[model samples]
Target: MTTPNVSTPRLKAPAEVASLELNPHDLSATLYNNDLAPTTRKGRTWSSYSIFTLWANDVHSLGNYAFAIGLFALGLGGWQILLALGFGAILLFALLNFSGFMGEKTGVPFPVMSRIAFGIRGAQIPALIRGAVAVAWFGIQTYLASVVLVVMVLAVAPGAAAINSNNFLGLSTLGWICFVSLWAIQLVIVSYGMEMIRKYEAFAGPVILFTMGALALWMFIQAGGSIAWSTGEAKTGADMWLSILGGGALWVSIYATFVLNFCDFTRNAISKKSVVRGNFFGIPLNMLLFGVIVVMMTGAQFKIDGTIITSPSDVVESIPNVFLLLAASTALLVLTIAVNLMANFVAPIYALTNLFPKHLNFRRAGIISGTIGLLILPWNLYNSPAVITYFLGGLGAILGPLFGIIMADYWIMRRAKVNIPDLYRTSPTGTYFFTRGVNFRAVIALAVSAVAALVLAFSPAFAHLSSFAWFIGSGLGAVIYLAIAKHGQEYKDVSGEEIAVAPTH
Candidate 1:
């Protein structure tokens, strides 16, 4: 009797099977490292309070102080500045949640998250833009912190000012010394990784907050227990409205870099509730508290002396007690380090690693990033308040499109669903491996939107609109991306895949 031939079921291809089981923790070196991989359960330890203190430390820096007070130079009254802060804080809260939600859901860093929107290899473009901007800010913050150190030294020993007479690379000998010293201190702190950074932030934020409150109290006493909040030069009608709007734009611009890369921090949070709660308290409420303290201190300083003191270092320099000066100076030092690490250093580390995940890990990337930051000589970029304002506007223009593309892809096109395994895959079998591992839709969208924003930011005819560059760019980016992507295969490929949700406790 002829037996019926039994046919074996066709076996799935090896690559296909592997793709189905591509665990984030076991991803290839070219696509993953300990630093760039999705956070493990143990790694997701940051509480709501931890996230709150992160903002607290980041907001209370000398550079941020300069940024906030610089609005006064543009003709905003203390009350207007506070209003702007609130407005910007609301904008920041929304933008951060858009980006932070991705991290909270996926437990991945910003560069890794970009892979969903931009292909695995194409992710490098946005990463490079972010890294370069981060390096510039890192150098700028380092220089700002060093200025505080220089002020402290000059206060303690007036003879240190002699070093200023011999200038090198637009900075004094003492300036170089202080800059390098602070740089090293930050590098040492970064070497301990994110956990140490979080702990340090918890300690640093409260110290600076306390010091700022005390400083404001002392200023109130010096001003005979009253502070006059003045409207500078009396702007009314469109001019006043414009100034207020610009001031709000400046507030957002100051935090634009952090907002874009907030996933780097939020991925470590224990819950989305933690991220949202922390961000609310950290941004809107935090900005309110910080803005009031700042206005009080600066206003009181103006009352005591006819000149406006915009710099925190200047405020500390004006203090009469040597002990308090020393204490305040030390607190400001902590302030700068915390903000620099939180805002500047951490971003580029992950970004550069994303560029060469096989060759670079976090520490190596940090070293390279720090070296580039030092070489750029950021003091040149930070000359005056006008320069700072324009610089941030231009930066926001470039970065806003990225934020737009990311938000659009995730929330609109993909409907908050990310293919976790595909994010690390470079093979065409992976959904994200479109166009030989590049998503030209995202590339084109970024290019077109950023160009438009840049024109608005730099054109003399559109100078009044420059302050709105971030808003304009981000809005244009999202709209353009949505328009372009709707016809693309990536948009159609959206399916109900089982996404690996991070445990939210």
Candidate 2:
């Protein structure tokens, strides 16, 4: 990574330097520098492999495989499904590039990036929303992962089946025990902070990938070298294309939510190149390869069972070798938990901290978020299709527009320049201190775009548009914010000169 320019004035308050006409060339480096503790300088440490491994873990999970196969089976032929997967992956790649650029340029986390659009105090709005969503997902992913464990244990010890007979709120006693155990394990991993999390992802990523490959190869061989892609049901060209497009769009949007927040991790990267390279390999390549493997496995399973099988657990259970099934299932459970902890768990910890930096440190904030997830367990939100659709769709809608507004404000309005110190200030002189630390323009844009997206999600008349909600929300949010900012009144210029503050020890 390029070094931040040390010649720039050291400001006590970031707002004091907001008006300075900084060279656009230094913008990326400045953003990157901002992500680290002020005590740590650039190039002193790097995390390229750690970041790359995080993606490996994220992509190689059972949930991802299930989701991929489900998309393919969305009434589309194999070729059409492949097209959709490629299209979705490409869109995701582009989105990640945009968001990741901000992190590379400014070494700040996602919540910190929100300050540019939402204002310092107002940033809490997005932070809280994002963090809450992450927490819910964290719980769901953990629960799903634990299911594999339950299945594996019951296979080995038949007595454990009784654990599932007694139920509470739709979940069996064994389910509850597994959920709590998984939750506790995640909490323990997160308590050690990002470094430990990074290490775990790195170690678990390769193992999961190798195991998945082995399972796929074994399944294909068991099918006697005649693995047909045909599902036996034929469809017209138009119908097939539509299915592919719709399925692709949904899958893309599902993953795209995190692209906006990718800087939360990439800001710790060793170089902008590393971030870009990792994303290229991780998003498109990994997703495409994974999709193909999943489809192949699905086809093989269909031929064997004479019915569709979406879950990896079901596929494993069908395997003749009990030992192989147990080993693969165990690996999958570990893989799922690793990804869940890293992607869904750590995100909210940092975001929640950004909400109340003075009061909530990282560890406490993580616990708080995790606890909220646990509280929602009684609702059984994870199991309901309607609930899952609304929850994921609603959050996905907001994420797109919020990302658009932030990117537009930073790259277009501010020209990639940020008064780092002012980002945390509460004074009127602060650049982000617009109307009581709130940017009405951004709020209005968010509201408008979010409304549009929600309408598509819930209203049957607009149902077709639901597939592309992310693009619509983000584009409209950007346009709306830009238009408002163009006419909005300006305040005092606090740009160039540095304000005095003690260096962080």
Candidate 3:
């Protein structure tokens, strides 16, 4: 009996083992986890640089340039435009820093982090809303990127102009060809996944910076040295300040939607320090430099053409040398496509999958979302100014409240302690489970703020306050949620793995 003595192996519970098993149905959730984990401490520094490159790609694009100059076209002078750009960029910087901090502290993506505020299941509401908006923008940006491809084709084979003669739904045959081709190109790039995107940005960021600088210099030379303000009529200082504030607020609001979700990418950072530093270099410095270049180029083009040119393509076309014009156009095309891919394409792919973790995996969800975006193309729904304004404004309204609620809940209410494991569990005992998977305080805060923002958006009486909708909504939501949740009830005790919130410095 003594000789037959044996040792027993420890048996692990099936439920414990099951948690570690990879579920193909939840590929998006898996990717989200992979994206959030800091695999190496050294890689943390790259996060900031990656985010900085992201903003560089975002700010230096043709559309952003056009938007900057469009402010001047609103009867504001060059100085006023500069003021607006400065103010708007600063506001965006601040908001992005706050949002990025959450990612850095928790090592979680935006949709997952949102579960803390909106609840585990309720997070789907914001995810779907964001995904829908992203899909629409993705289609529009793809269309814009195709413009360059079409131009290159026409330049090489002049016969291609004949394709433009036959039209369907306001688009020529050549335009449709370019659009589909570019769309397919983006799809292929996205399919390669996020690592490819990082490499693409590393190259695209510097290339765009160089080409834009060269184009600005060429424009200045063509204008014969100096350029003056192109304001058609002079205005009082008071009027100029008013215009600047209005324009700046509008720009900030337009940017606010994306800025709130900055964590989506930054969560991959290996360290929080890198993210803050990267945002510092990226937002204010990069944007200010890009804004200056845009203003200078627009001024130079104004002097030469005797009419203000808002679009970067218009500036490219103004160059007398055909070769230089072609070069600039090609660069703008590359820059546009890079930004469109980063900002629009990747976000929705992940977001949509988050909505149906048990049904659509990442690739399948991306396909579904992409297909829906294509279906929306024939209507040209994205082109309508009224619709675009409403879409952006409505998103801003919801996002503002969401941001506020998350900040208040994390920093003010919980004192920044998040139970990481509980985020994945649907048990009533989870930290995020509030009233059967919905936080009523957050819901009410969002609803109230949204109604106020919508009123500001649609009612002429509140038109004067419309530009500040983002700020108003966020501020109100944070205050209201804090007031409600502060005295109401404390969250239930969950698993005791306490993660410290990074201190606000």
Q: CA lDDT, every prediction?
A: 0.80, 0.72, 0.71
| Local accuracy of candidate 2 as per-residue lDDT tens digits, 160-262 | 9878898787689888888889889888887776666767888887888788777778778878755657566745677777777777777767765587778
Query: Against the hidden true structure, what lDDT does model 1 obtain?
Result: 0.80
**Maximum-lDDT candidate:** 1
The alpha-carbon RMSD values of the candidates against the true structure, listed in the order shown, are 4.2, 8.5, 5.8
CA lDDT, candidate 1, residue 79: 88
Give the distance in Å from residue 67's predicted Cα in candidate 3 to where it truly belongs.
2.0
Model 2 compared with the native: what TM-score? 0.86
Off by over 4 Å in 2: 1-46, 168-170, 234-238, 487-505
Per TM-score, the best of the predicted structures is: 1
TM-score list, all predictions: 0.88, 0.86, 0.87
The positional error of residue 394 in candidate 2, measured at the CA in angstroms, is 2.3
Where does candidate 3 stray beyond 4 Å? 1-45, 168-170, 359-361, 391-393, 486-505
Q: Report lDDT (Cα) of residue 98, candidate 1.
A: 78
Q: What does candidate 1's lDDT look like per residue over 290-379, in tens digits? A: 899878877887777767777777878888899889999999888888888888898899998898888987778888899888887889
